[model samples]
Target: MPRRGIRSWFTVRVTTALFTIPLWLDLTAVAVGAIQGAMFAARLTERRIDLLGVALIGVIVGLGGGILRDLLLNQRPAAISDNWYLPVATAAALLGMLLLRVFTKLNGLIIALDAVTIGLFGAIGTSKALAYGVPEVPAVFVGVISAVGGSILRDVALNLPIALMHVGSLYAIAATAGTVLLVVLVSLGVNVVVAAGLCVVVTTLTRLGSVRYGWSLPEQRALGSWRVWRRA
Candidate 1:
């Protein structure tokens, strides 16, 4: 065999070994995402969303990230390819609907779950991108998209302003920080599972802290005012 062929083969194997996540964990992330989506839809009582509408929103939020990630990677979407994802998402969405009042009262729990969901998706996306030999920066981009793709789609489907565009919590920023950390740790030969765990922790903490303290990126107007003040 040619030396180049051997090197490529070795890289593929190592990357695959390092980045693949267990199926159960991935599904858990999907379930949480679905629940969040349903809850968001439920909150819009004024929208007059029907039961079908709620389920659809849940499925979109649950599966949107993975679908987007797969499309970008030019692969079949795992959510569709696997039999379990759709049913799980649908059921979880219904569950969310059933427990809406309870969840609303426990808003902190929802926020915590949201943070963990973001981390899980981000880690999964980054790992898959790395396994596919995507460049580090691009992998981080993919991860962030995977983390927030569902919410983006939900807002678009409902014709609402995209939360990502608005100055809200550190949603994308937290995802980016986690993904970047994963890439850095992996490059340093850290254990893949450990790095992923750390990614989740960092992402979750950043998200929770932002929520707790109302941290947000400066809006365009704020930035403009700062610049004018500097000029003065």
Candidate 2:
């Protein structure tokens, strides 16, 4: 029974990874990521970022995942070198600006897409990291970073508070969990697609559950040496 369960989870992860992406899917994710970047920019920068900022954010969202992957792998950034990642991100950001207000108002839509983004990138991150011979634990970290780095960049650029820093339903936690889960399943000899599918389902459910139930990790305790700090 335990073996079957592992197999099932692994199958789930891989299917989620492979099947969800269509030949035409790049355009959608790039667009969505770009827009997410732009909206983050609009609120982040103390003063508005000009066209350059928008374009940069777009690129960040579109290619950010892949770039982080390469950097972790100790290779040159593919995001900067390869394909249409730049243009796609820029276009998405521009489009995002148009719809951001409306999108923000609709919590459900944002939540749904955000969940998708987390799943896609988190799994990709895990896959790429492992390819570079990253250990399982670090691979999971890489995956989480890829999943959230772009948005984090956008928020920092906009001068808005970092999303991860604030109180919200599990955001990075979901991505990290998915990546780690996939890695564990693969180590156990489960099929790749199944692993990815399980990752996505786990990620989506975790995020939705967090939002639905206000789930959060406990606050960190102070250091072992509890010294009362002197006021300045």
Candidate 3:
């Protein structure tokens, strides 16, 4: 019947949209992460990292988060299973390295992209954990790990101080906020895709605001001193 045909068409369109949106978003995250990694490596003049080293670092940054997430969940990494991921990451890294000067000049743009990258990763990670029946709190933890795992690996590889441990922009906090929001929204019957999009927006705004305002958690020593003074 005409009604049946219309319903079938709508269902097909909706299913296709759901599948394609996440795929594109994941690819976008990989590309941005690779570019950011390449730029970071290129800036470290003292390290004298070669093109291959830069590319490797880029790949690690691009794929590290998802790998960590899967490992924590006791599953094989999706990045490894998918063919598109590696090629996209490598190409993006090369592009970043080749155009280092241009990207460096657009620092603001890079920061924005970095924010978006983390948001996407966090959303994807949290959603996946929930899909696998991970509890709410642990799902948030996974999301945070996925958001920051790449940078953690990069710092370790480069022998730099771990950014998460130091006073810096609220990277983990932003991720937590976003993931929590996504969980809450989903519990409230929001569509997963729509919730994920909102999560990205919240995370992006939090990250950008933190950078603009120099917002960061108090240093450990500072917090200790405050506690001592309060006791006094």
Candidate 4:
């Protein structure tokens, strides 16, 4: 019975570890995030993420979105030019495995945290853009896109329908919602921390509600009965 129980707990740990993993190492937080992301993909189907594959995905997840965000803002590529990023990703990968061992049931917890990450992703992009004097509307969109881009890449690599595309929570919608919220709040003269907190709250609630009640936006389909009849 104990052996069986251990196996069951092990399964849960593996999933959570595979699921909520993040980039934690200070050396290069972004790189760690990328490595953790690819490890996430590799673990979903029980296939080992070899050094090359994991490294590639790690870099992709860690720096790809930021690169795009920076380019859009006309800044230098931080991950490539900076020295600390790669080590950060490596440490984050190892830390994920350790965290998994500690929490046997973390899928839900990870998802919750992932929402916060999304919010941070959006807010960071927006604030940075604004600091650089980018216009409000463009800054907001850039923020929202950067927030969702990492997950999009992670999903595509895993061969799963992007969660943002499926019926269920408004993933992109949440990001968009947060981005707009930030823009409006800032325009109204709210402090950045306060504005960011509100953005995170909205984004988190949007995601949590989707998880809790399976909420999603309306689907598009052609209506066969709605053909227009011309009255001559």
Highest lDDT: which candidate? 1
By lDDT, is 1 or 2 better? 1
> What are the candidates' C-alpha RMSDs?
3.7, 6.3, 6.6, 15.0
Number of the top-ranking candidate, with TM-score as the measure? 1
The TM-score values for the models, in the order shown, are 0.90, 0.77, 0.88, 0.72
Worst 10 residues of 1 by lDDT: 1-10
Give lDDT per model, in order.
0.87, 0.72, 0.85, 0.64
Question: In candidate 4, which residue pairs clash?
Answer: 28-85, 28-88, 31-89, 32-89, 34-58, 34-62, 35-58
Return the candidate ranking by TM-score, descending.
1, 3, 2, 4
Q: In model 3, which regions exceed 4 Å deviation?
A: 1-21, 226-232
Give the winner by TM-score: 1 or 3: 1
Model 3 per-residue lDDT tens digits across residues 1-232: 4334423433554355434566777998999999999988988888889989999889889989989999989889988888999999999999989999999899899999999989999998887777665767888899988999998998999889988788876989899999999878766656778988999999999999999999887776776566656865
For residues 1-232, write the lDDT of model 2, one tens digit per residue.
5445534544555456544555355456556777777776665556757877767777776677667666877888755665666667777777777676787897587677878778777876786566555767887998898778777766666666777866664879999889889888878876666776788788878888898889987544433434533331
Clashes of each: 0, 21, 0, 7
User: Comparing candidate 1 with candidate 4, which one achieves the higher TM-score?
Assistant: 1
